[model samples]
Structures are given as structure tokens and as C-alpha cells.
Target: MRLNAAPRLPWMLGLAGLIPFVATAAATWLAPIAWQVVAIRAFLGYAAVILSFLGGVQWGVAMCRERPGETPFRARMLLAMVPSLLAWPALLLHPLTGAWVLVAGFVLVRFHECSRDGRTQLPDWYQSLRTLLTLVVLACHGLVIWRLAGA
Candidate 1:
């Protein structure tokens, strides 16, 4: 799909959603040392939430397109739940480890989304937007990891 063909609102909202990732990542470096731990926790929490939301998006897609009792439907539903499952454990780990977990989660989701079956199920615009957003999110996670690792 042409880049401009993507709706403006989702793009706007998606970009807006990056605020917390950006802000918290910045806080990890720029905020007072006392607040750094809080910022790290906040970053992990937000990443987990967003990862779950992405899974929900997959669920929504499956619900809208697949018929009940079908193998494809079951498979898609199972895949949809994977992100939330991955995100949950990250919350209990150290900030550096948690950031790496989230990084892997985002990459796995995006990789699936780029697969042939995934490309067929989702809109071209949605796929494009997801790719872009996932890249930025991964970069933010990298920043968090860098900070947490004392780099």
C-alpha cells in the first residue's frame, strides 16, 4: 500500500504511544539518581502493557477473520497469547534482563507479522505501521538495556 494511504489517526496515536518509552528511557539517564529505579520499573511496565496490547491486536485479527473450531483459528489464537505470556515474566526480572526479554518479544512478534500468513491476514498499512513502530520500540528497549547495564 502507498504510505499515504494509511489512515492518519492510527499513525498519530501510535506515535503518541511512544511517549512513555521515550520519556522513561530519557529519565533513566537524565532524571535524578533517586528516580532512576522508578523510571526503569515504569519502562518495563509500559513495555509489558504494550506487548500485551499487540497480542490483543493479533487476537482481534483472528476473531475478525477466522472461523471457530478451525485449526488456523486455534493456531492464531494461541500465537496471539504468546506476547502477553512473554511480557509477564519480564516484569519479575532485573531491569537489564527484563529489557532483553521485551526486546526479544517485540522482535518475535514483528518477525511473525512479516511472515506470509501474517502478511495475508493483516492490512498492508497495518503491517507497515507495525514494522516501523516495532523498530522504534526495540531501539528504546536497547537504550534501557544500555543504561541498566551501566554502559
Candidate 2:
């Protein structure tokens, strides 16, 4: 997909979202063993924050739909809250558990936005962007998990 397309803003923002994941993951790899826990905690915390932000975005999109009748107001509202709900507990848990929860949340949210059984959906370019972001985030989390396993 063209980078300069109408979805450029979201695409750029989505890519920018990787900064925290990459930075923390890199730090976890490079930092001393004693500092690794701190780095992982930061990574998971950042993931939870971003996940919450994404949920808000979903809520906004649903609320501002061009066709309000496409999805019932209550359903859209409930669906929109899912990410934040997931993210909150994630932050409270251990790093490993929180990372997994965020990863699952990302995958589920992407599916909710892109699937044919669409209630509230994103534009094609945006969906594609979300797919890319979700994959990268999941990979980063996988690395975190793997490192934790080997620790």
C-alpha cells in the first residue's frame, strides 16, 4: 500500500506506536540482567497505555460513523470499551501475563475491525495498517515472552 494515501496519518501514527515496543524490547535485550525486569515492566505498561488509546479511537470512530444505523449505539459502545477493559487488568498483572493479555487484545480488536461480520468497521487502508501494527506488536510481545521463558 502507498504510504502517502489518505490513511497516511493513521499509518504514520501506527508505525510511530512501534517506538515503545522496539525500544523496550531492545533495552530488555541489552540491559544487564538485573535491569531486564524493569525494562519488561515498562514495555508492558506502555503496551497497556497504547491499547487503551486504541480503544478510545474505536469508540470515537463508532460514535462518529457516517451511517449511525449500521450498528446499534449500545453495541458499539460496549465493543468500544473492550480494549480499555482488557488493558486495565493487564497493567495490574505480572509483566508476562500483562503482555499476553495485550497481545490477545490487539488480535481481537483487529479482527473486530476487519472481519466480514462487520458491525463497526475501518476503511480498507486503515484495516491493513492495523494488521501490520498488530503483527509487529505481537512479534515484539512474543520476543518478550521468549526472553522471559529463557530467563
Candidate 3:
């Protein structure tokens, strides 16, 4: 995945996406108790949002085909909703569980996007971006889990 020369938008957005995760992780270590709580909630909430966005990307890609001839539209749409469905429930669980679920969702979706059996067939560059973003997200999530466990 050669995204170095890709459009600046995805690259910029990809980097920007790290902000919440990084901030939350930093807060987990450096912020006061009240602020840490706020940061953890914010991080989990943002994780859910991003997971849904990734699902929507799959939905959009599946629906974008013009001359589609029975491409399992129903199944594709249903599959596209899986991430959001997973995310919503994760929000209701314990913080550790929720973070773990989000990490799982992120990684699972990324694998799907990159796999041949995957629902969405994205460009290599996009896959690369997803990988980078997922790594940062997982790291932040790990930090959250560690902090919560130590608490």
C-alpha cells in the first residue's frame, strides 16, 4: 500500500483520527480522576463512532456498484451493520470489556476489508491507512485497559 503519494485528504484525516485515541491514552496516565473518567468515556464513545464509520464504508462500497447483478445486496447490507451492532453493545459493557470489544471490532473489520473473502474490497492504500489507524486505536485501547485494571 503506497499511500505516500496518495491524496492529502485521507492521509490528513487518518492522522487526525489518532488524536482522540492519543489524547485519551495520555489522559489515562496524566489526567486527574475526574478528567480520566471523562477521557475514558470519550474514548469509548469515539471508538463506537469510528467502528460505525468503517461499517458504513463497507455499505457504501457494496451499494456503489451500478450494474450489480445479484451481488448479495441483502447479505452485504446486513453484514455492513455488524460493526455498529457490535459497537453499540460494547458501549454498555464494563469499560475493560467495551475497550476489548472495540479493539476486536476494529481488527476484525480491518481483516475483512483486506481479505479476499472480505465484504469490501478496498484499495491497497486504503488498507494501509486502515492498518495504521487500527494499530493506534488498539494501542490506545490497550492503554485504557491497563489503566483500568491498575485502578
Root-mean-square deviation (CA) per prediction: 1.3, 2.3, 2.0
Q: For residues 48-139, what per-residue lDDT tens digits would candidate 2 score against the true structure? A: 88888888877787687635765555566677799999998998887777878888998888777776643345565776676677888888
Tell me the spans in candidate 2 whose CA falls farther than 4 Å from its real position.
1-6, 66-71, 117-121
Of 2 and 3, the candidate ahead on TM-score is: 3
Q: How many collisions between residues are there in candidate 2?
A: 0
lDDT of 3 by residue, 30-129 (tens): 9999999999899999999999998898788778742345655665566689999999999999988999899899988887777774634455578677
Give me candidate 3's TM-score against the actual structure. Answer: 0.90
Q: Give the runs in model 1 whose Cα sits over 4 Å from its true position.
A: 1-3
Q: Which one wins on TM-score?
A: 1
Residue pairs with colliding backbones in model 1 are: none
TM-score of each: 0.95, 0.86, 0.90
The predicted structure with the larger lDDT, 1 or 2, is: 1
The 10-residue segment with the lowest total lDDT in model 2: 115-124
